[model samples]
Target: MPKIIDNLHEKIFECSLKLFGEYGYNEVNMKRIAKELDIAVGTLYNYYPNKQDLFFTVLKKSWQQTFFKLDKVKETNYSSRKKLKYSIKILYDEIENRKGLGKELTKANVIKKESLDGIKDRLDGIIRNLVEELKKEEKIDIDKEIEERLIRVFFLSVIDMLDKYAKEKENNIKFINYIIDCNFK
Candidate 1:
């Protein structure tokens, strides 16, 4: 007869997420996660083949939640600028709370280049929506090509700042507004 452990997968994921966010990719391992969950390392392996697999799973799951929230913000009836600002706030908070998880993923080589690009594409979609909205309002005087380039630059700037200074919420918001004012005002 097999012994049953209730919600073991969820338990493992929760424990792993907390550990990974706290200690980062290189600093964590199956044994430590198992120990934290009071389970055998082999049991963890039964769920996730290796550290990379586990880490990637946790990252994908976490990103899904973030994407979902961003989706909700996208659907809101707010002004385009307000929606963009709220979306950015959500992303900034995610980075601050994750505490270098992005760096860990990049440094550990856990996620593929294409997958990272997919994440960027999704974020860009959020920003692009704002551009579309502004264009509809006839607020953007730039040509399409220049508008696209600016969108990429703006997205890159946001990502850079969020990754580099996640803890500085005030400054980041101000920087975003500066970009918005300079471009749209």
Candidate 2:
């Protein structure tokens, strides 16, 4: 039945997400995904042409989930500084939760560099919008260019620290708090 086929399709996607999360992007293959879903490799290929296509679908799904949470944060009636802090925390928690998977994804050759670049650009746009909103609420006393540059630097620093000190939760919190206090104070 069409309903049974749809259910199977959903199961395949769920299995793929778990496998990718556990084994990393490059380590997971269509055969393994199909096996995990109790389906044949040819069935998997029928839905997705290749492993790269499947992985990209998974990545886009993950991004959509993240953006949904962020949209909620943006809708809250909190101050811009508070919103920024929450946004940073969301990103930090996501990266920390998938630390190994993220590192592996970066190293995977199957994923194109342009794909990562596109993700970066999207994230940058989100951060830039947050910074612009904060500027409206606070007296930053800086030129637009300088403000944008500072926000970019801060964003990069947070990402770097998240990658470098992922295991040190206390230290990471301290660093994030320090950055917020210094910049948003």
Candidate 3:
């Protein structure tokens, strides 16, 4: 089992995310993070070797939280296609709701090195499940690999579009539904 961090580490992450989200990553330095945490700069280093590690941890936490939310809403009255649509809509809604809760993806600099592979892997896990369920209902061309790419593309395309729409405060259920309608068909 993995080691659990103490409350202080959690505080560090929370404070860091809040400040980073509000001020932009470039302006939120270790001194600022330390000041917000009410701890010395050296203390945070015990939890994270450096700012990059902290940022990476925050990004991973965000992804995991997103996955958890998706899992909670996995059971719905929609078809597999609709389920996927709802899952993405849920993601967009969460991002919009939590826009200032953490660092903005577009502006995040500390965690820049994090590849899309982590997101891709998590997404593939979801899509694989969807494909399995979808297979039970209809004949899908799983062997050619084209089907897999299409699912990934469809998901990414819709999420990216909805993410773009999220820039405006008004919850764009129509925009979310639009992507859902176009992609999850």
Candidate 4:
């Protein structure tokens, strides 16, 4: 049945995500994924041409999911500052979510140039939107390219810091609030 086939596809995706997360992308393989899923190797090949293709499939899906979550919120209702904060917090929330950061990082690493560009395009698009929103409220001046670059630099540094901080044995809202207050202020 079509439903059963769809379920198998979903199964492959979910299994791959967890496998990649538990064992980094380089360490995981078709055999491991197939074994973990109790599916035939042939069945996996039915959906993926090869491991690289499968990894890109996973990577593309991760970006799609992230964009989908951001699109749900209408930025019009909030102040630009609030909207920008919401954007940053929402992404960090996604990154911390078991399904997002761990899987996305694994997904990104497995891909080559084209996929990396695709991921970068999505990120740059988000950053541009955030900057534009702030400009609307005069929170940031649009004329200064230097200020824009500086914001990007600070934002990225914060994200890198959060990525490492989140992996610590202790990760909670308290530290997150501290991050916002200390950095964004």
Candidate 5:
């Protein structure tokens, strides 16, 4: 019985992720998610009392998956520039793939402002780790504060450009490579 309950919970989470990723939090409701999972609304509520709870649960899981991938990239035997590129590519791909849901969440203010800050802080920590790895590789020599600032600027600029001109994939890579070279070289 516990195993069956676990399976039902997993099904709900999977269905919620799909619906939330495709339709955004504002447009998706518990009823829709339950229907998509072929579960009763009461069962869905038993798992997640409210939409916000379910949304945050899914968001937390997605962030964990992203961090796991980034951690794997960090473990790779690649050059600092290559590592940074791969990390950025991972982020860029995620953003591009979920552009619609991202825009919807932003436009609808579905996520709280403080939650956004938390997400930014987590992303910055990943960048900081990358920068630290680069430092260990003797690829960059700068004060910690300056390095962090530069990373923040570069990351934000790249995201902005990608959001604005997502179709220019090659150009984006070139632009990112240029920045990496100019900074680390």
Candidate 6:
């Protein structure tokens, strides 16, 4: 007979998230995670096959949570500019909260770059939608491709910048607002 632990999966995920954020993916391992959770390493394996799987699961969950928050902001009775600003704020906060997890993931190469790229593309699509809405609202006469490319650049830059300088959230928000207000509105 097998013994079942209540909310073991959630427990594992929460522990992994904290461990990964604090020590990074490279420094943390299955043994350490299991130890922190007061479970046997084998039991942890039952939830996640390996370290990479666990890390990826935690990363995916974090992104989904950020997207969920952004969706709520979208549903609000806010202007397109407000929606885009709040969405960027949500993204910046997530990046700050991740605490070098991206760099660790890149260094470890545990997952293909395409998997991360797909996540970026999804986020880009969301930002692009908001940008397009603002552009249409303001009747801006910019090229679609150029607008998209700029948004991609800005999005990538924000991640890089925020990760490098953790204290720049307010400045990033201001910069984003300035860019959107100047060009889109």
Q: Report lDDT per candidate.
A: 0.77, 0.72, 0.63, 0.62, 0.73, 0.78
Please give, for residues 121-140, the per-residue lDDT of candidate 3 as tens digits.
Answer: 77678867865666665554
lDDT against true structure, model 2: 0.72
Displacement of the residue 93 alpha carbon in candidate 1, Å: 1.0
Identify the runs in model 4 with alpha carbons over 4 angstroms from their true place. Answer: 1-6, 98-109, 142-155, 167-185
> By TM-score, how accurate is candidate 4?
0.75
lDDT of 1 by residue, 45-71 (tens): 999999988988887788888899999
Q: Is candidate 2 or candidate 3 better by TM-score?
A: 2
In angstroms, the error of model 4 at 142 is 6.6
Candidate closest to the true structure, highest lDDT: 6
Candidate 2 residue pairs that clash: none
Poorest stretch of ten by lDDT in candidate 1: 102-111
TM-score of each: 0.83, 0.79, 0.68, 0.75, 0.77, 0.86
What are the root-mean-square deviations of the candidates from the true structure over C-alphas?
2.7, 3.3, 5.7, 4.3, 3.7, 2.5
Poorly placed runs, candidate 6 (over 4 Å): 1-4, 102-108
Off by over 4 Å in 5: 1-6, 99-108, 112-118, 139-146, 157-162
Query: What's the TM for model 6?
Result: 0.86
For residues 85-135, what per-residue lDDT tens digits would candidate 6 score against the true structure?
888878778777877664453352756676577566778789988888877
Candidate that scores best on TM-score: 6
Q: Can you list the residue pairs that collide in candidate 6?
A: none
lDDT of 5 at 119: 58
